[model samples]
Target: MNKNSKNLLRFAGIFGLIGAILGAHMAGSGSYAFRAVHAHILVVGWLTLFGWAVFYKIFQTTETVLTKLHVWSAIIGSIGLTVGMWLYMVKPFNLPEGVTLFIYIGGGVALLLSFLLFFLLTLFIKEKK
Candidate 1:
């Protein structure tokens, strides 16, 4: 009903889409070569973001710069991680191996930073008297 809820639902839809693709891939290929990527998409993209959104909604936290940063970081981190891992798994983009590794590492760091920001936000939550 609120912005946080909307964001969570939107990301839930994203997870659903990724899950569908994963299911189809498994059905057709019978190989989980991209399993890590799929997992990241679900966990980081769907679960983490949804969890934070729920937290924000329930706590009635006002929108802050950190919240916006969290949203963007989560989005970018998820996409970067997913795409980077996919490229790492399969050279679909024809990028150099080192470049793919860099992307994967960078994505991981970005995701970590987002989590840290979330933690910071939690610490700053106003307590109900």
Candidate 2:
């Protein structure tokens, strides 16, 4: 497996564990406060990352600058978005509103960019003779 695939899979596993724990915590506490955060963690962090990892493992694409960008962006975006969501919604640390908003928006933009790059990557897949 490619290094990117391995890294993504690792990230996905971590996210999956986090999401599960959060879900369990919510259930036990009877509080749905972390609902959106948990959902995003599972979807964006676990499922999406896992899917991307699988893609990289199955398809032998030439690694380019775009590939690096996409990999890093996906990882960073996932962390930023999930953490930003928690900070924004929960405000556990009572952080400034502006900071939380910026993180949330920035993370979302990065994730969007990752998606776009992934689409372009698909278009340039090396055909197996």
Pick by lDDT: which candidate is best?
Answer: 2
Among these predictions, the greatest TM-score belongs to 2
lDDT per residue for candidate 1 within 1-129, as digits (tens), equals: 668667766876787688679868977999877677777787877788788767766675677888878767776777777788889887887999999988887887787888888888888787433
lDDT per residue for candidate 2 within 10-93, as digits (tens), equals 999999999999999999999999999999999999999999999898888777898999999999999989999999999999
lDDT score, candidate 2: 0.93
lDDT of each: 0.78, 0.93
Model 2 quality (TM-score): 0.96
> Candidate 1 deviates by what RMSD?
2.2
Off by over 4 Å in 2: 127-129
Query: Model 1 segments beyond 4 Å from truth?
Result: 127-129
Give the lDDT of residue 18 in candidate 2. 100
Residue 7 accuracy (lDDT) in model 1: 77
Q: Candidate 1: lDDT of 82?
A: 77
Number of clashes recorded per candidate: 0, 0
